[model samples]
Target chain A: MFTAFRDHIEKNFPQLLSKPGIVACSGGVDSVVLAHLCTQTGMQISLAHCNFRLRGSDSEEDELFVKKLAEQLDIPQFITHFDTNEYAAAHKLSIQMAARELRYQWFAELMDKEELSWVLTAHHLDDSLETFLINLSRGTGIEGLSGIPPDSNGIIRPLLAFSRAEILQYAREQGIKWREDSSNEETKYLRNKIRHELVPVLKELHPTFLENFRKTQVFLSESAQILSDYTAQLKENLFVPYHQGYKISISSLQELDPLRGYLYELFKEYGFHSWNVMEALLTAMSGKEIHSKTHRLI
Target chain B: MFTAFRDHIEKNFPQLLSKPGIVACSGGVDSVVLAHLCTQTGMQISLAHCNFRLRGSDSEEDELFVKKLAEQLDIPQFITHFDTNEYAAAHKLSIQMAARELRYQWFAELMDKEELSWVLTAHHLDDSLETFLINLSRGTGIEGLSGIPPDSNGIIRPLLAFSRAEILQYAREQGIKWREDSSNEETKYLRNKIRHELVPVLKELHPTFLENFRKTQVFLSESAQILSDYTAQLKENLFVPYHQGYKISISSLQELDPLRGYLYELFKEYGFHSWNVMEALLTAMSGKEIHSKTHRLI
Candidate 1:
């Protein structure tokens, strides 16, 4: 299984194996397994842990856990604390958004200081499936179905090929200790509802559901790429820069078979998502126009 | 509600409103409500019921129910009996497939002989949601995510704008009678499982789940259309006629960012679905080939 993981990384992302990088380990089973795998594969890797301090002592415990694991493995570790609630209130962002912004911003600085080639996060198959479901439940387009990408710039997901069950099994076998985030059961969170309720039932319905989900993710991602190319050509043919934004030819758009979707895609980059209002604009009076803060469709 | 139904047809499906068409009634609340709405709108619609005789006396009762309803409305009616089991065995198809083939074949003939311009079916929002779930559970691509199309050829679905709950409420208000199909409870089937088990929980999670699903479906369908146009252009650029089959340049294919999906979409017309083996062929020995019964890729 480890060899297969190595082979997948080598084939799809060879650069990660050839150089030193930072492993964003939270001392969870997923990240711990990823770090262990990287060490076993003879990759020069160090651990980075983020303590948002949102979970009180639990946050401090997680930071300490990753520190001990790194020390035990004879590897270097870096830790950071984030004032999540303060940042969220100051920036008018959600707690999740604040934490994500602070964490990634810190990871960037760590990369430059450590001279690491990339950052590896333990985003596994389950995480990807949950993200796919979250987007689906929230009404996403072609691009949303792609799930979590395996490689994005210098950030890579090494454990993406493995499932949560596989990671738990591996951790138990290796006697790995980690902190469990109790917030995982909070149904108020959209991701938790999908992960705890929707995904399990879907998996129980079939023996190979996860494998099939992965394949479907791959298909949607590919279809999205093909659509991007097509939509780019359409934008070029039908849209032009105007006063403060752009003008889209209504006549050309009306000629489309499914005009709503084409119009949606054309104006999507400009922040228009409501299909009903956009659809009505197509047949509105000649002078009718729809406007978002960023762009306008006439 | 009936006025809204009429308005929907007038706005989006004006052809159906202007001419006569066959209403494919199943003697259910859905079709009964649809027929009543058509009459209220002052359109010419005749009910055509397909009695597959799979449900013995129950099937005959449904046929009688539809005939009586047509008589009550003072409209013409058509009924046909099909030997579904024999058809399935003879054609090496499932009973459902056999019934579908038999029903559609008869519909075409009915249309031409009766001089009807189109066929209308009461496939409501709930049915569309179930189909979406069925496709998702079975691991579908963008095309599958599109759900049921609103109009295909001369077939129009006016009732699609309404959900089953709305239709049921309408039926109660109008005191409309309908035959209940007992086979609906047989959860042994996949579609039934999705409708009964999955859809309810999803709806319960949010007040607007179905609405969101519709938006997602429309976006995906549009995306699928754009992708088809793009792939057609790509095939023109990257493929050439060679010997017994077409030749695709492996190098050009390799240049694609998401190669696995592009390759799947390329070979999909040839009935190739597996990507693992097909992906390996990209870097396999130059002479290596992946062959289906109808097509080959070298």
Candidate 2:
């Protein structure tokens, strides 16, 4: 498992190993395994811990646990505290949202100041599936189905390929002790509900659900990237820039089999959501124009 | 609900109303509602029924119910019985697959014989979700995530925008008599298991799950279409014909942000399944060539 983890990183993210990066550890099995693997691979790495102060002493223990692990591994460590509830209230956000904002903002600053090349988060396959189900229930697009990306901006998830069970098994075999956040067990939160209630049933129904999702995720991600690159090229090849926005040839577009999709690819950025309105434009009399917030397609 | 159904068809599939079409009815509430609505809209329509004979007397009752309904509505009806088990054994296919093949093949012949423009089925929103879950359990790409398509290959699903509950409620209000397939209630089938055991839980957790999936499906379908178009265009622009197959410039490909997607788009038809092996080819020594049964990319 460790070899697979290391090999995946080397194959997919070789540049990551060349840089001095920080691992965001919550003293959980996922993060501990990631830290251990990075050290075992002899990568230049450090530790970053954020005490959101949401779980009373549990938050402090998480920070302390990470600190000791970092010291034992002879890696540099950084720790910070935040009044999470206050931050959430002041920002008019959920506690989870506030923590995400606070830690990511802090991590960005630390990455720059401490000369760290990348910030690593321990988001595993199970977390990816949970996020997928969460996005499914909530309104989302194709990109949302892509789930938690492996690398985005300056942040990376080296453990994203591993499942929670794999991390737990590795920790047990390696005799690694880590703190568990009690709040994770509470099912009041949607993510927790998914992790605890929904995921197990899916796993039971299809034993290879996670591996299959991994395969689907790869296909989805590649297809999505191709769509992105295609759209970039389409802007140059298809659309002719006009006064305010662009004028797509009505006759040319109508020739496209899926008129709705063509209209969406062309006009979605202009903020038109309804296919009904756009479909009408295709057959509407010439000189008719669609007025959107940012642009127009006639 | 009927108004929305009529409006959705008028906006999306005006071609169906332009000519006479046949509805494939199982005498279920879903198809009964659809048949009522299509005639209600004054469309040129007929009824086609297939009795797979899987449920003995129940199958005969279903045929009788549909025949009576057609007679009452003053519409032409077509009904046939199939030796499904024999067909399944001969074709070396599951009973369901054999039924699907027999029906669709028959539908095609009927369409041609009757000069029908389209074939309608009563697949609805819940069915689409069940299919999405089923496809997720099985490995699939972005197109699989797109869910049950509203229209495909001359087959139109007029009730696709409505849910089963809506169909039942509409049937009750309209005094529509329909037969329920006993096989649908059997949870041994993967689809039934999903419909019975999973959907209700999802609905409880998120009331808008169906609507949200509808929205996501549109985006995925559009994005998937765009990717296909883009990749087709890429092949013409990027790759050069070399030897028996093709040659992609290594320097140009390496400059691409993601080499895997580009290579997949380039070489997928050649039948290379492993992206990792193909990706290694970009940096591999000049003599190394990737092989598939039909073609090679060096």
Candidate 3:
């Protein structure tokens, strides 16, 4: 595990090892394992902890555990508390969404303030699989099924190639202690249900389910990148700038096979999603229009 | 259901209506519903049934049911029987695989003999979802996750756009009678287990689960097509014909982002799946060769 971690960092994230970064630690096994690995690999990293106060004393204990670990490892530590429930109510967001938004926002701010080049998270392959399932359950495009990326913006997920089982095994082997988040056991959340129920069944069906999923995700992400590149070229040829907006040649668009799919991808960023209406606009009488919340096509 | 089926046919399979085709019937509700829809849509069609003889009298009953349905619909009928167990033992295949092989091979022969332009199947949205889960559980790339193709070769799945629920409702509404495949309820098969257990949970997660799956599949298939097109262009530039085989430019291949993925896709048809070894070949000694079962890359 240690060798793999070092090789992974060296191969894919050499910049991470050369510069200072922060590990977003929850004091959970995954983050704890990540922190251990990062330090062992000689990466300059600090611990960052969030106390949403949802679990009361458990939250404080988690914060304390992180602080103690930072002290033991002789690393800098940062901690913050959020009025999560109040924020969720005020922003009309679910508690999970509120926490995520607050967490990432703080991570970005901390990275800038602390002169950190990377903000590493402990999202492993299982988390990616869970997110993949979540997106798949609700129906999503290739990007949604592509799983959590290893690197996006300045944020990095170095543990993404490892599975949850591998992380747990690593923690146990190293005699590492971590706080168990009680909420994780609650199946009321769809993710928890999938993690606890769905994933086990899938794992049982194949010994290399997670590994296969990881490879599949790589293929999908690459395919998505290829499509993005192709669309960028297509946009260059099709979207000629007009007075205020771009004039697209409908005939050229029609010439593309799976026109509706290409149309969706090309116009999706413009807020157009009613695919049927968008498709209809192609063959509708001239001057026919379709409007999204932010954009219109005529 | 009827309107959706009609629209799907008119939009995707209009050619089937203009020419004669055969519907692969198992005396199941899905196929029965498809047969009714194709006939109602004014498609000249016949019923083709394969009795693998695995279900004793039930298999005979299914064949009889399909025969009676063809008579009722006033269409030509073709029936064939296979010693599925014997075939499985002889071919060293699972019973299910043996049955599938026999069924498709017979369908192809029947199509050739009867001069049918198309061979239609009753594969629906749920079946696609089940197949997706099955492939995912076993680990697969985009093509596996793209769900079943609606049209492959001369085979047309006109019912692919509809769900199993929709098919059942249509059959009930039309007062159509069909034989029950007791084997479908057995959880021993991976597909059946996923269909019975995982699908219900996924459906519970979203009201439009099947619709979302269908839409996602469209995006994936389109993305796969785009990648395939891009790779075809890459091959044209990089794979120079030399004597007996093509000599690929290693540096040109290396120039691809996600180089291993591109390598995998480009050489997968040549049977190279050890991506790491293939990547190594790029920098290996000039004459070093990587051998697949059939092909060798030097």
Candidate 4:
């Protein structure tokens, strides 16, 4: 496990070994193991903890455990508190979304103050699987099924290559003590239901579901990159800038098979979701227009 | 329902209206509704039934239902029987796989004999969803998630756009009587478990799950098509025919962003599934070769 972790960092994230980063510790086994692996691999990282205060004393204990670990390792520790429910109410967001916003916001501030290169999170293969299932059920394009990327923006997740079982095994072998989040056991949430029920059944159906899922994600991500490149090239060929707006060649667009799909790919970022309206634009009046929330096509 | 069915045919399968075709009827609500729609649309389609005999008397009843439906529609009917269990054992395939193989093989022969333009099947959106889930669980690439194609070889699935609920409603509205295959309700099989257990939960997760799923499939299929085109272009550039084999340029292959992924896309058809050895081949000694079941890379 150590060798694989070391090799992974060396291959994918060698910069972490020289530059300092912030590790977001949830006091769960996933994050704790991540921090441990970072240290073992000679990567410079500090522990950062968020006390959302949703789990009362369990939240406090989680913060305390993370602080003690930082002290034991003699590294920097950053802690933040949030009244998550109040924030959720104020923002009209779910508790999970509120916590996520608060956590990332704080991580940004910490990174700015501490001069950290990246913020490392402990999202594992199982988390990606849960996310894949959630997005699939909710209905998503290739981007949604591509799994959680190892590197996104200023955040990096090195543990994504490993499964939850592997993380648990590593923690056990290394005698790592971590606080368990009680909420994870509650199957009321959709993600929990997927993790607890759907994932186990998927695993039972295949001996290497997680491993195969990881491979599938690689294909999806690469395919997504290729498509994005193709779409960009197509956009370059079709869209000609004219007086602060680009005139798209309808004839060129019509040449593509499944024109609606191509239109969706090219203009989806502009917030247009109505395939009917976008498709109809091809045959509509010369001056007829379509408006998305962010952009307009005339 | 009739108008939508007619519009669907006119837009996508207009050739079916002008030419004669064979409808593979399973004596279920889906196929019965499809056969009715074809007749109503003035499409010349004859019903073809395959009694796999796996369900004993139920198979006989299904065949009888299909035969009556054909008689009522005033179209020619073709029927075939196979001892599916014995075939499965001999072929070392599951009963479902064996039945599928027999059905398609018989359909091909029938098409050849009857001078049919296409073999139509009643594989609706739900069946595609089931197949997608199965492929996803078993680990597959983008092609797996793209869902079942509306047209494959001479077999065409016109009902891919409609949901099972819509098909059922159509059948009821048209007073189209069909047999209920008792085996569909048995959760012992993986496909049944997915259909009965997984699909309902998925639908409950979102109000327009199936509708959105259809849209997602469109995006996936387009993405798959784009990637396939890109792969073909890459293959043309990198592979030069030399004597009896293609001389693949290693430098061009290595220039790909994710070499292993590109390698998999390019050589996967050659039956090479060992990605590790394939990647290692890049840096291995010159003239060292890797052999797949059907092809060799030197």
Cα lDDT, model 1, residue A80: 90
RMSD of each: 3.4, 4.6, 3.2, 3.4
TM-score of each model, in listed order: 0.90, 0.86, 0.89, 0.88
lDDT of 2 by residue, A120-170 (tens): 899999889888888899867767788899999988987778888998998
- Stretches off by above 4 angstroms in model 1 are A186-188, A236-257, A272-298, B236-257, B266-298
Interface RMSD of each: 1.8, 1.8, 1.4, 1.7
For candidate 4, what is the DockQ-based docking class? Answer: medium
Clash pairs for candidate 2: none
Q: Model 3, which residues run further than 4 Å from truth?
A: A53-58, A83-92, A182-188, A240-247, A269-271, A274-298, B55-57, B83-95, B173-175, B182-188, B241-247, B274-280, B283-285, B288-298
lDDT of 3 at A234: 79
Q: Is candidate 1 or candidate 4 better by TM-score?
A: 1
Residue-level lDDT tens digits of model 3 in A111-204: 9998999899999999999999889988888899999999999899989999988899999999998888777876248887787778887886
Docking class of 2: medium
Better of 1 and 4 by DockQ: 1
Per residue, candidate 2 scores C-alpha lDDT tens digits across B56-159 of 89999999999998988799998888999999999899988999999999999999998999999999988888888878887678878888888899998877
Error of 2 at A33 (Å): 2.4
Clashes of each: 0, 0, 0, 0
